[model samples]
Target: MTRLLGFPIADHRRVFIIALPMIISNIAAPLLGLVDTAIIGHLPDAIYLSAVAVGATVIGFIYFLAVFMRMSMTALVAQNFGADDMAAQRHNSINGLFLAALLGVLLILLTPAVLELSWWLMVPAPALQNLASDYISIRLWGAPAALMNLVILGVLLGRQQSRQAMWLVIATNAVNVIVDVWLIVILDWRVQGAAVASAAAEWSSCLLGLFWLRKSLALGWHHLRLNLKQLLVLLRLNGDIFVRSLTLQLCMASMTAYATRYGAIYVAVNAVLMQFLLLISLGLDGIAYAVEALVGQAKGQGRSDRVRHWCRLTLLWSCLFAVAYSLIFIAFGEHIIRLLTDIDSVIDTAGHYLPWLMVLPLIGHWSYYFDGVFIGLAQSRGMRNTMLFAALLGFLPLWWWGQRFENHGLWLALTGFLMMRGVAQAIWLKRHPQTLL
Candidate 1:
């Protein structure tokens, strides 16, 4: 309903322009995990597959915690861009990189303790634990590069330069796939090969991102100084986002732990299904990312009407994609599951739960969309609180009751978590519409 020059704005075109490249980039992301899974799945040892699965999940949790850097950077940069404040944008980029570097180093230093704690919590089979530990240890080396890349990607997305962002993602995943195939399949190095492939890819992308940033921004070194007030604001925004991400990760980790308790077969099955879930979420997140940039820009320009219009269009596209994705999963999930693993037990177990994957998009797409809207509006506190309530009140309680149903209970709890997130956030936003202003 946004009008320009007495005509309706073609916001869909704007959304698609940003969202399309991101969708491809996001799809490529899960392919990295799938390649690792497939390569290890064929290695004649279920432990190898389970090890990579658990290790990746643990590393994912760690990396996800730092996602606030990306989210906050995106919001800050987009708003600055809208106001034509190139200086603020430059400051944000530099600060984000610095923060990412600091966090990445801290993660590296804490690797031993993290691995110890993760193993204690996961309690995988002995063989699985050892292999997983090795994977986590090796991948931790890339933490600095990986976190920096997140900031770089955030900068690109915030600028509405999604094409470059897409290229970066493609290049990164291409490296991951090539290395994974050569080391895991050809050399038969197993889980270690996959970890090495991922680490190598992370550093590769980081370097590429640095080169791109230098060329794109062309900023002098003098422009990179940190602003204390902005840093404080960034920290507060990221703090809320960190808590939100933590709660979400807790739900994911809890699901993994519950699945692990059912034995390696279930763990592997859940991992495969999780890939599908990741694929959907990331794809939907593409739309959300587009919304963030567009809405943040509008908000910065003091155009509340434009922000609302963009949000409406984004949600419509998200719903359409959700319906389409659900159908595709219902039709071809079995085929996809088989492609991910050759272990017959893993394949069978995953197929039995394919229905959950099919319905997940419909139930969860709104949360992804809403997250973008909130981030664009700098409503991190609402995001943090909504996730807390959803995880603790909605997910944990449901999980407790659903545990009686075994894996079914686990899936149900997860579904509740996703649905509750969207519902709670919706209610909160409705009650406090000023947050969007």
Candidate 2:
């Protein structure tokens, strides 16, 4: 068939064009982490990057945990579209919004505890530690708004309204970039500038997202109601997503904490390395997300043949990208790290590990790719269970065992985590071939 899942190439092209912007916009958010590193790295004080490191790590925990809102919302909305139910789509968005807000408020309140733990973990120079606290506390205020923006974007993507998701991201990041300069250059707010810029942009983005989401859901305003049945459905779907996110964060946090023991420069440079990982993953993520949306829609319509076609096409694309990614990472790893951080020590630390980084694009690509397929299948419980199991059995054990060693241990543990994900998700997918069918 010339067509893809009955939608035709033209239909996919339209979706792809729209999704490109969302990918670009989404890409900018991760840059802020890089920006934090760059700004602090270039500052008169070398310690600034370390400050950003500790603060960014803490805030990252919040963002990573709440990622479920995006994952679940996208899958749910796509399913509703396939079912031809506009009402269900609207309710899912609303439910995501309410939940996002609740989670954000809770994060704001619990930030003090998070801050305390951060201080305990980092015995960096006292000045650096204080800077970290200030940056983290300021950044925490944006939690609610940032989480809401994530939910809104997910909802838009789910609806195949990729253009809108793109525009929202562009506007938000534009704001973030502007404030980042003004506060850092003019107000001379070092770490404060980076933290506040992120928070302000997040809140601004949430406002913009609300405008878009409200316009889309306005028609069903009077009809939208969450009774027991609907509430249970919403919880079940969102809960699976939540569990998956929690497992991911736990696994990642282990990596972060372990990096700290290697020293701040190591952790800071690795932080930059991780940003590269996110950028590469998100670029390819566009394809995986597209596959998920299409596959879910096909499954909704009970078209197993269409599902098969989409999955095969997606795997083909992933294989091609895998080869390309390995080449790029191997060839340009140093140049990319240099562009992000200027510190000699940080650069050297990263260079030593660049070889392993090359391995990630090829060997580690499956985890990110499978995550998309599982989400599309709405096998959140399976994914969540498998991920958490890996974190405990595969990830945590190695990470804990590695702590007694040098950089080798930390590197081993981190690589082991990604490898476990690839192997475990593959095993899980093979056993549940019904998902592909």
Candidate 3:
């Protein structure tokens, strides 16, 4: 237990307060995808599900790359709050939204190139590619709105306004799910309908977030002016995060591509399995988000002891949750698989892959927790280097050799990648003890 003012304090309450809303938000984030999957999976053909998988994977890659905006904004805002620098916090919020708008437009403009490049790399079948193209085209239009929401959400989390952030996420995802069902099931618009629903929900969230920020921070347009030096720092921080995100996205895209090579059934199976993994990762990330704000604040206040205390408590909670998740997966993996897709073939194939899913929580929790710690500290370089090492030295080569094992090999390589990420980051922390302290 940590002590303050000569009294013992329970860290779990503090941590849980920050984490609970985020846990709901994080879980809701993936439930959006799961909803899309469940909606599309019931269609007569597996192609609809496969197309959604590939299209969503590509868009997810692009959007995730822009996640630097969210991560950087949270850390900067949290640090500013810790230092009692209201002006700087407001400035960061304004500039973050501005940057997000810029990046969003760029993503929209590059849609054609992105689609061309994605098709080239993925080499999906003609029918599947056509459906995927339709999906991506519509979804790309939402990039700006989606990215803007990321920045706003970051600001909320950084300020420890978790309840507000939680409601925003819940509302946004609820809109997506309702619209998705109406458009796809009621109107029979299929893949394009899913895209439209997502875009509408994204824009709604962005607008709602801006409205919330206006009331919460009372921000003024005059404060949105660009600062070249601050912009440089933002870019530098986001640049490192970009590299880190790129490597992570590459690992993900590679998994999808490799799975595609195995056949559409495998691709669909992998897609469903990946959702389970996403659910676990996002749930764990709730804790990481809490750590990001808490650690960043601690760092800003020069409270090294508080930082250490947070790290210990967060790691303990993460391990316990990982155990709980593993047990749940082990017991209900088949039932969950069946729930995601009604197709006997897809369900049966995914069942064969359940063991990997069952074990993933245990192996992957460390890397996820450390990610929050590093992001909170705003130490992007270590994250970048470790991911590079993990992807290039650990995952890719292992994936190559594991090809003999087919889909099993792919899962094995991914497992190795997760383990290596945690191990390498641990070594990095050992070498630089000041980060945690």
Candidate 4:
């Protein structure tokens, strides 16, 4: 019954227990990109870094469009965990894996067309296009593993098995970094080396995740039988989240596409700046993930009070973390950019836009926190609606009007998009107070 920071020690302990490992894990996720960028950035031409950036953006566009698998699994499995329904948890995992596999195969099949369309739209320099295509061609092979890994991660986090999830992600990215150094740095494989390293890591992590979850995965044959009702529930939730995720990725990819119009310098600069944004968003997502599990559990137990309590705590922790990120970026943004690249033009161009990155955490944390809350409650409709509103009404207009400013305009659009999501989510929560139940 002891208290700390206006909450019981037990409450605080539970939050940190679920959050710390995730914070570490999610932070490492973006750090992997930073490692990739740093490795590629040191090459003789800025073109290599630009190629990797374009390649990554295109692949991410495809993969993240399907991240609904991970989001839905976490919400569903967490609720099952709260209800102490072990069998249902296993069932959800199995169905999610099946869905993930199917989607992965579809992505692979569409790769040739996607690559052609992506480059056609972006239309970068001829050399950049070829190098990026080289990276994409190899990277797509890991789609199945990467998608499968997302389900594995969702199940682990939903079960509150944060330590296992953390290890899986860390080990995966560690392999990636090591391979990047060997293939890209030592062998000088250029952009293709980075692609192989990432693809290898994805497949390795998929195997490792299965190993870690072997016990939970081992179920009676009956549990493998798909229940149409439960599967429908999963599909419905994932469908909403899919729309939300796709919209979000389109906004992100649009920024990259717009940046290309300004030349390779802008594209390279945006790529470097984006890493800072990713570091902040993914790091803050740790707190959001905790909120998701806890809130979902509380909802399963029919404890509306606990739901509200966790939501409030999510806001508080997210704010503190956002402030910390803003301060760090403001103080050391240039220093960080310098470490990522030796190219003087990239360094200077990225510095010009670091201010946008510095303030993004403050503008964006609310939507992230609210996203966790809604996902926990299995109310992805709200998330989908808010994201659409932000992208359409806020981001597009801002970008159109600000186009004369070039790269700065793109950043401005992104800022508007993120801020709109947070504001809209806040308003939605206020209006639908009953969602806590």
TM-score of each: 0.86, 0.84, 0.87, 0.87
Cα lDDT tens digits, model 2, 1-437, are 36765546775575466446657766775675455456558778877778877788778776877777888887777777777777787777777777788888888898888877767766667888889889988998998898898889888877777778877877776777789788887788888998898899889989988888878866445754544565566678678777877877766665566677778887787678887677667666876777667777776666778777666666666666777877888888899889888998889888988887777777667776777777777778777777776777777788678777766566677678777877888898888888765
Mark the regions of model 4 whose C-alpha exceeds 4 Å error after superposition.
30-54, 123-135, 177-197, 260-269, 341-355, 404-408
lDDT of 4: 0.86
- When summed lDDT is taken over every stretch of 10 residues in candidate 2, the lowest stretch is 219-228
Clashes in predicted model 2: 0
Distance (Å) between predicted and true CA of 390, model 3?
1.2
Q: Write the per-residue lDDT of candidate 4 for residues 59-142, one digit (tens) a residue.
A: 887777877888899999888888888878888888887788788788788888988899778789889889998889899889
lDDT of 3 by residue, 1-437 (tens): 78743334666777778899988777776667677689989888899889988998898878888899999988888777777788878778878888989988888899899999999887999999999999999998999889988899888988888888898888888898999999999999998998899899999988999999987777777776876666777788899889989888778767777887888898898889988877786669888988898888887788888888778878887898899899999998898888889999999888888999899999999999999888888788898999999999889999999999989999988999999999998899889988764
Candidate 1 per-residue lDDT over residues 182-203, each given as its tens digit: 9988998889999999999999
Ranking by lDDT: 1, 4, 3, 2
Error of 4 at 159 (Å): 1.0
When summed lDDT is taken over every stretch of 10 residues in candidate 4, the lowest stretch is 216-225
Q: 50, model 2: CA deviation in Å?
A: 5.4
Order candidates by TM-score, high to low: 3, 4, 1, 2
lDDT of each: 0.87, 0.76, 0.86, 0.86
